[model samples]
Target: MLLSDARSIGRVALPLYLSMVAVSLGALVNTAALGRYGTEALAAFAVTTAVYFPATAAVAGAVRGVMPFVAAKADDPPELLRVVRNGTWLAVFVGVPAALAVAGAGVIARAGGVPAATVAQLGPFPLLMAAAMLVGGFGSTATSCLVGLGRSKVVMRAGLAGAASTAVLSPLLVWKLGLNGAGIALCTANLVSCLITVSGLRGRLPGRLGRTIHFGQIRELAKVGIPMAGTVLVKFAVLGVLTVAAARVSTTAVAAHNIATGLAGLTFTAAVAIGQAVVPLVSTRTEGVRRAVIAGLTITVATLAAICAVIVLGGAERLFTDDPEVRAAVAGLLALLVVVVLADGLQAVLGFGLAGLKRTTPSFVIFSGCYGVLAVIAVPAAQHGLTGLWAALAAANLAVAVGQGLAFRRASNL
Candidate 1:
C-alpha cells in the first residue's frame, strides 16, 4: 500500500522537482561564472544574495501556507480572491519597507568601513533584488492559488520560463556589464518570471485601487509572516557571519565557498521541491493516509539526495569549477555536504509535514532553535577554514533533521 501510494506521490512531485533542479542548476551556472571573475565580485554576490534570500523565502513561505487552505475552497473564487487580495496587500506593506531597509543597510555599510568598489555594487543591487522579491511575492500567492486548484503543471511551466530567462541573462550580464549588470539581470529575470507565474492564476489582477486594504488579513499575514520572516532573518544572520568570516580569510576563499555552497544548493533543491509538493497532499489526506504521505515524501527526498551525492562525488570539479585547488576544496566540502544535504532533505520533509498538519507554529518554534540557534553557532566555530565551514554546516543540518524528525513523530502521535 505504501509503495502504491508512493507512486502516486511521485507522479505529482516529479514536475516540481524538475523545475527546482533547473532553477538550482541555473544558479550553479551563475556561481561558476562569478567564481571565475575573482573574489570581490564573488563576495559582493555572497553578501547580496544572503540579504535577498530571506525576503524572497519569507514571502514564498507565506504564500505556501495559503495553498492547502485555499485548495480546500477551490469552488469558491470570491473567497479565494479575497484571501489572495489580502496576501497582495501584505506583500506591499511588508515588501516596500524591506526593500528600503536593505538598500539603506547597503548605504550604511558603505559609510561604515566597506571598500568603495564593494559599496558601489551594494547600494543599487538590494533595491533591484527587493523589487524582484516584491513582485515575486505576488506571483507566489497567485501560484499557490493555482496549485491548490490542482494546476501545478501551470506552476511548473511558469517556473521553467523564468528559469530559462535567468539562465540566459545571468552570464550575458556578468560577462558584458559587470556586477551591477548582474544585479539588473537578476531583477529583470525574476520580474519576468513572476509575471509569467501570476498570469497562470484564474483571478483578475486587482488594480492598484480595486479594494480598500483588509486590515484583518494583513495583521494575520504579519502574524504568520513575522515568525516566518524571523526564520529567514536568522538564516541571514548565519550567512552574514559566515560571509564576514570568509572575507576575513580572503576574497578568493569567499568566492570558492560561494561556488561550493551554490553547487550543494543545486543538489538540495530536488529535496526542497519534493518537500514542498508533499505539503498540499499531506494536508488533504486523512489521518490514516498521513503516514503514507510522509513515507512518500521521505522516499522522494532520500532518492534525490542519493542521486546528487553520486553526481557530485563523481564530478565535483567539473560541476563546480575548473581550478584544481578550488575543486579539491569544494569536493571535500561537497563530500561532507552530501551528508548535510541528505539531512537537510529530511529536515525539509519533516518541516513541511508539520506544516501540512496545520502545525506551522510548532515547526516554526523547532526551526527557530534548530536553524536559528544551533545552526547559527556552527558556522562561525567553523573558522577552522573551508573544511571547518563544512563541519559546521554538517552539524547544523544533522541537528535540524533529528530535531524536526522527533517533532514530526510526536505531532503524528497526536
Candidate 2:
C-alpha cells in the first residue's frame, strides 16, 4: 500500500515539481533583468514583488479550492464543467478586489519608508502586476481543475510556456522600457498562459460553457476557499513579520535572510508539489493518507538534505552574494532551516490532505491562531537578534505541524 501510494503521488508530483521549478526560474529571470537596471531598480522590483505576491497568493489559493470538488467528481464530465465554470467566476470575484488592493502598492511602499525616487520608478508596476494576477487567477482555476482531473500535463505545459515567455520577454522589455517593462512582460506571460490553459481545458472537456455566474456554487467554493486563503495569508503574515525582525538586526542580516529564504523556497517547491499531488488522490481515494504523509515527509527531507549538502560542499554562498558577513549569516540561518523545512513539509502534506477531505477550517484556525500569535510574539521578543528570529520561525512551524497533524488525525478518525 505504501509503495502504491508513493508511486501514485510521484506520477502527479514529478510534473508539478518541474512546473514549479520553471515558475521559480521565471521569477529569477525577472529579478535578473531588473538587476541590470541597478540597485534602486532592483529594490523597487523587490518591494513591489513583496507587496504583490501575497495578494495574488490569497486569490489564487481561493480559486484553487475548486480542486478537491472537481477531483471528487472527476468521473463526471458535466459536473467538472460546471465546477470549472463556477471556479472561473469565483476567481474573478476574488481577483478584482485583490487587484484593486494591490494597485495601492505605491502608497504602501511610501508608507513603508521606501525612497521616493524608487517609488516613482516603480510607477505602474503595481497595476501591471495586478493585471497579471487577475489573469493568473483565472489560469489558476483552470489549472486546479485540470490537476483535480489528473491532467497535470496541461498545467505543466502552460507553466513551461509562461516561463519560456517570461525568460525571453522580461529582459527585452526591461531593456526597452526600464523597470515597468518587467511588469508588462509579466502580464503578457500570464495572459498567454491563461489562454493556453483554458484552451487545453476546452479541448479536453469538449462541451459548451455552463452558466457564467452561479451564486450557489460560488458560495460553496468560498466556503472551502476562504479558509484556504486565510491559511496562505497567515503564512505570509508570519514571513512578513520575520522579515521585519531580520531587518531590525541589520542590512547584512536581511540579505542573509533573503538568500536563505530563496534556498528554502526551492526546497519547499518539492513539498508543495507533493501536497498538490496528495490533494486529488485523497479526494478521490479512501484511506492511505497516513502513508501519503509519511512519503511526503521523506521526499521533503531528502530534498532538503541534498540542498544542505550542496550549500556545505559547493560553496553555495557564492551563488547568492560575495559578501563574507552575508555568507556567514546565511550559513547560520540554513542550519535553523533544517528544522523549519521539515516542520513546514509535514504540515503541508497534512494540511492539503485535510483540505482534500474538506476539513480545512481546523487547519486554518490552528495555523493562524497558533503560528500567527506566536510569530507575532517571537519576532519582537527574540533578544538574541537574527538567531532569535530563526528560532521563533522554527518554533512556529513546529507548533503548526504538530497542531495540524493532530487536527487531521482527529478529523479523519485515523
Candidate 3:
C-alpha cells in the first residue's frame, strides 16, 4: 500500500525534485568557482548570501500563499487571474524592501564581525543579489502557480535553463571580475529562470491580465503567506546567525561551513519538493498524505546518506576546493552535518504537510520557540568551532522535527 502510494506521489514530486536539485548543483558549482577565487572571495560570497537567501525566501514564501488559491480556482479563469494578479502584487510589495535590505547587507556583515578585508571585497555582489531578489519573487510565484496547475514540468524546464546558465556563467564571470562576477552570473541566471517561468505562466492564463492591485486578495495571500514566511524567515535567520558565528572562527571555518550546509541543502530540497508536491494532494486524502510523508522521509534519508557516502568514499571534497585546511575542517564536521540534514529534511516534510492542511500557525509557533532556543545558544556553541555549532543546530532541528511530527499527526489524525 505504501509503495503504491509513494509511486503516486512521485509522479508529482519527481519533476520538482529534479528541478531543485539542478538549481542546487548550479549553486554548488558557483561555490566551487568562488572557492578557487580565494578565501576572501569565498567569505564575501558567504556573508552576502547569508543575508540574501533568507530575505528572498521570506518574500517568496509570502507570495506562494496564492498557489493553493490558484489551484482552487484553476478551472475558473477569472478567479485564477485575480489570484495571479494579487500574488504578483504581493511579490512587489515584499520584493522591493528585501532588495533594498540585501543591497545594504554589507553593513550587517561588518556588524557581524566578518573580517574587515573580506567585508572590503564585497563590491557589487550585494547589488546584483538585490536584483536577483526582485526576479526571484516573481519566479517563485510563477513556479508555484504552475505547480498548483500540474505544470511542474514547465518549472523544471525553467530551472534547468537557469542551472545551465549558472554553470556556464559562474566560471567565466568569476574568473574575470572576481566574486562580483559571481553576483552577475547569479543575477543573470535568476533572470533567465524568471523569464521562462513567467512565460509559461502567461500561456496558461487565457484572458487579458490587468495591473490592478486588489487589497482584499493581497490580504488573503498575506493571511497564509506571512505566517508561512515567518516560519521560513526565522529558520533562515538562525542560519544567518550561524554564518556570522562561523565567520568569527576563521575564513576557513565560514567557507567550510558554507560548503557543508550547501551540500546538505541539496538533500533538504528533496524533502522540500516532496512537501510541495504533497500540498495539493493533502486535502484530498488523509491517508494518502500520511503515506506520502512517510515516503518522503524515507527518500530524504536515503538521498542524504548516499550523497554523504559518495563524498567520503570518493574523497570528492576536493571537488569543492583545494584548501586542505578547509577540507579538513569540513571532514571533522561531516557526522554532525548529516544529523542536521536528516533532522531538517524530516521536519520540513511534516511542517509542509501541516501547511497543506492550512494549519501554518502551529509551525510558526513551533519553529519560533525551538529556534529561539538555538539563537540563544549560538554564541556559546561557536566557541567549540564548527563541531559544537553544528551540534547545537542538529539538536534544534531534531526538536523541531519532533514537534512538527506531533503536530502533523494531531492535525491529520494520521
TM-scores, all candidates, are: 0.82, 0.94, 0.85
What shift in Å separates residue 305 of candidate 2 from its native position after superposition?
3.4
Ranking by lDDT: 3, 2, 1
Off by over 4 Å in 3: 28-47, 106-125, 173-181, 243-258, 284-288, 311-318, 321-332, 382-388
* Ranked candidates, highest TM-score first: 2, 3, 1
lDDT of 3: 0.84
The positional error of residue 410 in candidate 3, measured at the CA in angstroms, is: 2.9
Candidate 1 residues lying further than 4 Å off, grouped into runs, are 25-47, 121-126, 167-184, 203-214, 218-225, 242-257, 372-389
For model 2, how does the per-residue alpha-carbon lDDT over 1-414 read when each residue is reduced to its tens digit?
777777777788888888889988998999999898677888888888876899888987787689889899767888877888888889988999888877888888899898899888777788898898889988988888877877788888888999999999999999998888999999998988889888888887848776667789889888888798989998888787777778877899889888877777787777888887888877786777566666666766676677667766777777989899999888777678778877888888888878777778898998888776767676575458778887887887899899988987887774
Off by over 4 Å in 2: none
lDDT of 3 by residue, 60-121 (tens): 78876766677677888999898898888888898999899899879998897888898899
Whole-model alpha-carbon lDDT for candidate 1: 0.67
lDDT of 1 by residue, 70-146 (tens): 55455565666766677667777666766666556566566667777876656466676667767777777777666
lDDT of 1 at 151: 62
- Quick one: how many clashes does candidate 1 have? 0
